[model samples]
Target: MSSPQSPQSPQPSQQPKQGIACLGVLGVVALVVILLVVINRGGGGSSDDADASPSPYVPSSAPYTPPGDPYTPTTDPYASGDPYSSPSPEPSPYTSGTCLNGTLPDSTTAQSVSGVEEVSCSASDAHYKVIETVPLSTDLSRCNGNPRTQYAFSYRYTLNGATINSYVYCLVGLGSYAR
Candidate 1:
């Protein structure tokens, strides 16, 4: 019969290989632990780090100013000292007794005219005198066919569907002029 086989021992080279593989695993775990410690050390907002410098990300207390002139509100025309102030009535430049110079375009018949200049009644060049001033209306009956009424003129300015200014002049011939 063959001699009884002795218990086999692991090869020396295989033993060293197992040892190196275990050392590589340990090295990886140690490297991970060191990285975690480094990250936590620099992290912000820990109360325990009382003397730590302020973070660069914090905003300053001063207000940020723009490059150009600062914003300013425009003047309000409606505003007065009184909070309940109402709009004052506009005074009409052509009143009932005002005289005007410059010849009429249609001197023979009563008609609407323009380019008339205001003058004193005593002025030598005065050609027409305003007998009555009134608000303009669609009907001409107010200034039409009257014996003394020589001409009628309406002036007005409108902006954005609203009348900004308006006037109607009912005039009579002055001097030797006839209607």
Candidate 2:
């Protein structure tokens, strides 16, 4: 009888295993190439065909106006026929008058009082003759440290031989302060 073969010897079946692995690798590569070709083919569109199509119709009623074009001078309907006509001058400031016995001439005019030593005036308040007229001095320190640009008339009268000082607290923007 022949001697028993050794178990560590090389086997012939390993050659077929290597061939199977190579075939699998080649198949994957071919599939990837086919996918790439299909994708690239769909993206290629003819530019000539796009230009041959009919363009969209636009109405001629609205002509294209370039911004660089010179602007035409417009005639104002309220303007006088004369181009050189001067604008009307503004009305003069408040008119000064004398007060009789602490009584004011018209309730609309401002007047000074000696009792409280305070100046007060209002259209709704009783008309009183103004003793003296003085411009209001505004303080902007309370306006968030910002300068006060505008002010409305608060008091029409001032103390006799005494000066009155006015102050503005809050500012008005967008109906109130920005913050």
Task: Please list the residue runs of candidate 2 whose C-alpha ends up more than 4 Å from where it truly belongs after superposition.
Answer: 1-8, 43-179
RMSD of each: 18.1, 18.4
Please list the residue runs of candidate 1 whose C-alpha ends up more than 4 Å from where it truly belongs after superposition.
1-93, 107-114, 160-162
- lDDT scores in order: 0.72, 0.41
Error of 2 at 91 (Å): 99
Q: Best-fitting candidate, measured by lDDT? A: 1
Using alpha carbons, what is the TM-score of model 1? 0.42
Estimate, for each residue in 1-179, the C-alpha lDDT of model 2 and write its tens digit.
Answer: 99999789788899999999999999999999988898678655567755786879989799878676456545674577666775433222232332112221222223333322112332222233322233453333233343431211223223554544432222221112112
What lDDT score goes with residue 150 in model 2? 22
Q: Candidate 1 lDDT, tens digit per residue, 1-179?
A: 89999999877898889999999999999999988888688754368677777767766687799776656546554465664775454545688889988766653334655677888899998888888776754234567655578776665656667777766667888877646
